[model samples]
Target: MKTTRVAIVIPEGLSGRGGIVRVTAYLTRHIQAHIPDIETHVYRSRYSDNALLKHLTAPFALAAFAVKCATGRIDVAHLNVAPRGSTLRKRLYQAVAKALGLRTVLHLHGSGYDQYYADLPAGRQAGVRAFFARADAVVALGDHWKRFMLTDLRLAPARVVEIPNGVPAALPIARAPNATPAIAFLGEVGHRKGVDVLIDALARLKAEGLAFTATIGGNGDLETARAQAARAGVMDRIVFLGWVDEAGADKVLRAADLLVLPSRAENQPVAILEAMARGLPVVATRIGGIPQQVLDGETGLLVEPDDAAQLAQALAALILSPERRAAYGQAGLRRFEAHFSVTACAERFAELYRSL
Candidate 1:
């Protein structure tokens, strides 16, 4: 069998910190591992931090990507699309691929895409429609996004593929006995992420005379989250580690007893998978592809978004019961190995590429 030559275009850098970046990096690594016969190349475009420049240069970047795809010895081109203000670039890239007669895949990476499409201007909406119509396939990270593309966006069901994000192997660490119950929140510290909600839950746990320390990793509006913790009188107990790379973040996950994500909205979160792979139980909000990854009451606990009391109850239960925590953690690790491992994800993609 001839090897498939694949070109991956990631305008955003490939540092593996954010969700999209992590997915692209992991997918590329997996492809290289499972399909060693497949030739893979990555093209990263430098995006300016300025919003205006980022918007204006999108078409040019796509055109450049098109030129590279047309000239290079590539069989398939995969573009990672995000709904966060990059719709124009995604459309342009898709159009260029269609014009050049190259098979293309648009791998979407965000949640709430129906709302995002409705908010687009009429002209931009038309462009987006044309782009999706012309692409060979549109890959959604989970069922929620696959449904959004089929029912809401009205894309053909045959063109959309549901591929859940997977977790990379965790670094080796000496397992710590269930001694101190440390809770952790990993992600942006913004309002949408519900950092304030987590702080409130911690306060409620304290009010009920529960003792636990929560460590927060990743950065976003830190001072505000700090103020919320201070107001709740749990400031001293909450440790803010700020932004960390993949390796450093994994270390934090390994040390925690439970991982908490109170996000108001989310796509498949890489942090949650990382936690599961590290044998830590998760307490996350019921939103987006999170439900697909975390089986409620089995591997982890799920609470409604922004519900402080429910979150507090869930956290307290795990903290007070070492046996329950260990059970959940072990279950989570098993789930990770069975379904969310990097090897399995890569094998699936290899099959998809062959089908294409």
Candidate 2:
């Protein structure tokens, strides 16, 4: 049997910093571990310690791409993509692979795609569509994203497939809550993530006499978030820990009771999926592919973005009821196993690869 080879294109900052890098890492790990028939190779398409260095190293990445494609054994190029420069870089790599007669898959990971596509001029939008149109398959995170590709970009529905982001098996529920309820927020602590909203919600909950402790992880606009928390008079109750690796993330997740992220923008939040995998009940906004992962009333609570009062109410409900919290946690774990486990994600990709 001929060996099935695939090139996983990702960035070099994959030392556990961004979401796309982590997803790429997980895909590589599970596919290689389970699918013995297939051979996987990683193509470091983007790498730099800084912005200026990234631009300078672009040609080298392309040269490496040329060499790998010329080797004559690669069957597919799985280009992980986002908006802006990510789209441009992946387009170049995909074009090169297609030019070399390899099957190309465009995996969309841009949460800001709607805005990004809308901001582009009509001609540029068409140009973007043409690039996607050239792909053998366009992978979407969920139905919402699939709709965006089909309706917005006018791509063929059959060409765009939905593959939800998956996490590994659930972590042991390790955090035992003390007198104060322990609430956690993972991902970037920026306005886009609704960190300001979370801060307001904390103040709102505190005023309502619902006490809790929040462990805010990840970076981005953290100083602003701290100021916001301080302004809300809840800074003392919140801890800001920036950019935790896999092991660090597990420790943080294990010690938290509720996983809350009121992001104003999102695609499927890998953080939420990881939280679910840890059997932590989530409180998040009802946006993007969140509804697909978080079954609102069943596994977690959902609120409208920028609505701090509503978010506070939701958090208070979970904080008030230990039984309800445990139930939500158990339900979330079941959902993670049923749909978002790493095995499920790997099998889906393997099937897609075989089809290509």
Candidate 3:
């Protein structure tokens, strides 16, 4: 097992704080611990999420990859790629890995990937196919993304597999029930995440005589979102904890009875899994792979994207009824433990590697 070397190529991953970075870090960490057959190395290809930083680090990243693979040490190259710049940066790694005859797995993780492919020019569209064609296998986050890779990309169906994202269990916390129940929102705050709609929904709940603390965490459009909250006269009930660290976020995830994610687009967010691991019920929009992770009505309720009225109605129901919240929360915990834990995800990858 120690002799089997694998390289995991991730862009802006080594020090980045984005969801993809966390995914790569978590899986790789567990793989090394759980599987004794493979020694894995993380080839940090773009340094930062910033465009200029990505450009600056490309040449160095390429050089590093070329040197590492030239030794013919890596038996498998597991590539974590998204769309646009992420795809462009990682192409060289896949190309070099293929040329070296290493087994390549292109793991896809982007909500807008389908649109990114469709919007590409004819020449670039062909490039996308050619890029993916180099891989020995393609890993999709869920069934929807897997269908796209096989049908849209025209890749062989046998070469694609769906491996949804997973998260580790939350740290032990002796949480005292909040007198006024807490409602939390994680990830970037912007039009894409329906943060504006969430603000409006708060106003809707206010009219219905519902009161709870709304903790909005993460970056992007805070100013615009703040103005929206102000206009809705719900600023008093909202708390903006800008860019929460892992520990800080875990606290919110554990304490909040209902975790809300009103995203317009998604591909099975790890944040939702984190909430589930904490036995926290979620109220996320029914978009993309979200339905696969969050079972509406069973685990937690799901609402249409950008519909403040429905989102408000769903949140208000959970807020008012403690019994319903506990039922949903416990059901969600069962789903998480059965399917989406880090150990389960690590074993899946280990089996995939063994097959290769």
Best by TM-score: 2
- What lDDT does the true structure give each of the candidates? 0.80, 0.86, 0.84
TM-score of each: 0.92, 0.95, 0.94
Error of 3 at 194 (Å): 1.7
Model 3 lDDT per residue over 1-356, tens place = 34567888877555666678777778878878778886788887866567687789788987887788889877888888888877987787887777878888888887778889999999999999989887888888887888888888999988887777878876655544467879999898898788988999989988777879899988887999999889888999999988876777887787787899998988778788888888778999998788888899988999999899999999998898877877888799889888888888888887787778
Clashing pairs in 3: none
Per-residue lDDT tens digits for candidate 2, residues 184-261, read 888877877999999999999888878789999997888898888888899888999988777777788888888998
TM-score of 1: 0.92
Runs of candidate 1 exceeding 4 Å displacement: 56-60, 118-127, 171-174
- Clash count of each predicted structure: 0, 0, 0
State in Å the error of residue 207, model 2: 2.1
Which window of ten consecutive residues has the lowest lDDT sum in model 2?
A: 170-179
